[model samples]
Target: MTGAVLAERTEMVDGAPSALAALRRGEPVVLTHARERHLVIAAERVTGRTMALLVRYSSGFACVAIEGERLAALDIPLMEADDAGREAFAVSVDAGAGLTTGISALERARTVRALAHPSTTPADLVRPGHVVPVQVRPGGVLERPAPPEAAADLCRLAGLVPAAVFAAIPESVSEPLPTALADLTTVRVEDVVRHRERAEPLVHPAAVAPLATRRGLLTQHTYVDVRGGTEHLAVVAGAVADADAVPVRVHDECLAGDLLGSVRCRCAGDLAAALDAVATAGNGVVVYVRGGAACGGQPTGVAVPADRDRVAAHVLRDLGVRSVVLLTDDHGHAGRLSAFGMPVVACAPLTPAGQCDLRAGAVE
Candidate 1:
């Protein structure tokens, strides 16, 4: 009847019967710990219905609460006591009540736990092979089953399986099964090829363009012209070579902050500054390109054909401009520009005061 006694009883039962099973027997167990009794019920029995139960303690204590089928299945009481007795039972119920429900509970708990803490599932930890369930969405509803090879390949990549590494294979051309199954360790050759394929088009030098908007200002925009078999630099040229003579502020699209306003980087600020600079130049160009990475909180882009720095270099080289002032929030872009024999000025340290002065110069 006391909380302590209930806990001792629950612990005493080696190979303890499930609360759900006990509820089916019409003999619901009263789990006691520290002179308190917590009611246990079969979740399945309460399915599609709500039930009211009384929680009691040895110190002549009691509380009443309502519970639904789903909550019962989760073994979590909807309402608990404000006292120590209820608090103690809550811990035991969370740990002991749901193990018998099979994979569903484990999966649900995995998701719930992941939201609060970084955790890996048994699947994440085991080497089940390179194969994983390929779904249209990651952690989304599965529409079609993954191909055997794709599953195996995923397993290998996850270290769930083992196999030989081979040359990278393109996801578009390669058979998903064989390509994925070919290797189960490191990044799959197919994955590497797929990454390269995705990245090549975005990073290729010829895919970029530079334009001068006004007498002293410029803007550059990058694009993927999939319409023609050849990559077109039309957008950049059109913006820069507009019959105006304004200075240009060549800006790369920052997928992270420009679109999402990620606080980690000053992508959006740089973009706004570029546009204002070009406008002040009275006739300038602003070349804008898509961010070269995926959309994420991190200061990096997703897999793409060309990186923003590479596109900037291509635009600068085409203009034949010597010692152009390159502005970017990230210093990483500087190293990238160096490879193209371009000079880079990391605009990171420029304060708002400095930016204001630069904008003034653009107008002058």
Candidate 2:
């Protein structure tokens, strides 16, 4: 392409309508910073195809970022404790003119405070969340801003509303960013959340069979979120129909512990215990959230706690469960479920001595 054509395309991308148009169509735009190339997509529009494309292009890491205003709109609670008891979703931003490449507690608290009130100084303009580390064997090279100026620039140049930034590096050099600028793929925020019309999950029912250890039958059903492209598994043992206060274990997916028998965590053992406990009770369910594994051996990335909880609740309601006994600790899970009037019993995994405690604080 001639410089004239390239300049025209740049002008189109730099135009406000250009960015909004790409985002509305669910496409990502190329963003260059310090000669490092990155793909900037709207956070709300992330989908399976977009993720696949990112995986194909990324060098290693990708993170979803949001502006301070958007973070405030999420209504996340302010930090209730010091650094020792900081919350998982709590993120920090630089309120003053300073460097913030790494996550700092003081910065996080200040960011929270700043968001709650008017800023004494202008923030550098971004915060990050839900980082997914991508590994590309071969592909186009891609990179994102250390402080998120690149994403902000893309949003500004494209005239797209800047709520959240989904930034990733593509790996291959064979295909550079589109010169046309308007033909990028984009999706709506509803696509990522699977809200309302897109909330229905694709269900796959597996065969039921008897288990020797539990002395009962087990049936597996997989629920795949069409919007997020993540799968959650449900294991039903015995009968669960019209079962009130069913014994339920919302186990996080553990690849190393559950499969490789890693001793660093009790995930594998706890999973088994939950199954035996449910079988002994003669009726219960185990909703295994795919993102829970502590070790990396699985492709499923971590799900935001809030989004995961909501999806799990939907699965339970569909299974005819009204109330449940949560098998693990994570008060956030209990608190969220409780709001829906679901009575939850936070229990610890059985000890090696064959004894267990129910009144424990946040079991692993």
Candidate 3:
């Protein structure tokens, strides 16, 4: 990979720490989603410079992101409906009496401070005023992949109160984030998602049962999630816990290839081959995760959304699999997965058969 590609990947997977560091230092970060990007900073970090940045760059009126409970604490209700489809925006507000005409950057900054403060109550603000208040979902971006939730999530991750100030950046997707501001951090919604998975107990166990597959009778474990996700499940091919280091494949779903055998990708072949490898070992794991995580041969690596691996790491710990020989070619995963509590993937590829080029590594 080139230097730029490496830097971009770092921003995607491990950028949260840097973003949090920026927040701690009272700096701003650029936030990106699908086709949109925003300038975000912890509400507590709303300095004069930050406010100027928001005021100058925002395509619309800047908003403060807070939890639903915070919105209610201020006696604020939903804005009936969002015409723009930007959900969770409560009514606009000013910082009550003695507050400036809320439109000014300074005034909006004060209102944001009040919104983020713990002692601020309903009497502290007036409704239908200048500053827009957005109620982020309780589960942050994992529940709703919106800029408000993502902005708020950064605050939570940084150990501050879960409140943030964000405004749309009028830049296009192809444009580089304008470097006009100092201490400007940059991150993605996917970064927030990946950050949460890495830092929180993102997946929860609900049930397990025997699943009859073409390979054999695999034990399937299901999970409950805030996303109402059914796609995150695990299939244990054999008694992996009994082994010192079991062969494991953290597979992401690619329906086009896995089901219809679409030659667009080798997902079907790799999954089948992984299952076969585990079955043959009679002591391995094949974790099914990610709706369409992009990997190669099967896109299961650090460059991909290792949300699947993070999910798998938790599942493996839950399943009592102490160590693992990760079945993947992407050697980069070992370091990342280790942080999620699994030992680093061993350095060997378990190539039992079927051209599934799975790497084998020693787990120690």
Q: Which has the greatest TM-score?
A: 3
List per-prediction Cα lDDT, in the order shown.
0.32, 0.48, 0.72
Model 1 has an lDDT value of 0.32
| Candidate 2 lDDT over residue span 1-364, tens digit each | 2323322322322223444566556566555433455565654454446544544565534444434344445443233332222112334333444535423333333332343243343344344422421211110011221324334333433444442334445445435444443355432221122222123333333334444553567777677654455678878877676565577877777676688965545567777888887777777888777743343333344435554565676667667675666655555566555433344544443435332111212133
TM-score of 2: 0.39
Candidates sorted by lDDT, descending order? 3, 2, 1
Q: lDDT of model 2 at residue 105?
A: 31
Writing each residue's lDDT as its tens digit, candidate 1 over 181-203 gives: 32212222223222222233433
Query: RMSD to native for every prediction?
Result: 23.4, 20.6, 9.7
For candidate 3, write residues 1-364 as lDDT tens digits: 2323333343335567788988877787888887787888799778767788777866757888898887877898888764334677788988886776677778788888888888888988888887788887777876676888889998988999899988887764245545564447778787787667556665688888998887778888886544556557777877777464678887766665677755655567778788888887777888887653543334343334455566777778778787677776556665455545566436345453323322222111
RMSD of 3: 9.7
Q: Which structure among the candidates has the greatest lDDT?
A: 3
Displacement of residue 315 (Cα, Å) in model 3 is: 1.9
User: What is the lDDT, from 0 to 100, of the residue 162 in candidate 1?
Assistant: 15
TM-score of 1: 0.28
Per-candidate TM-scores read: 0.28, 0.39, 0.62
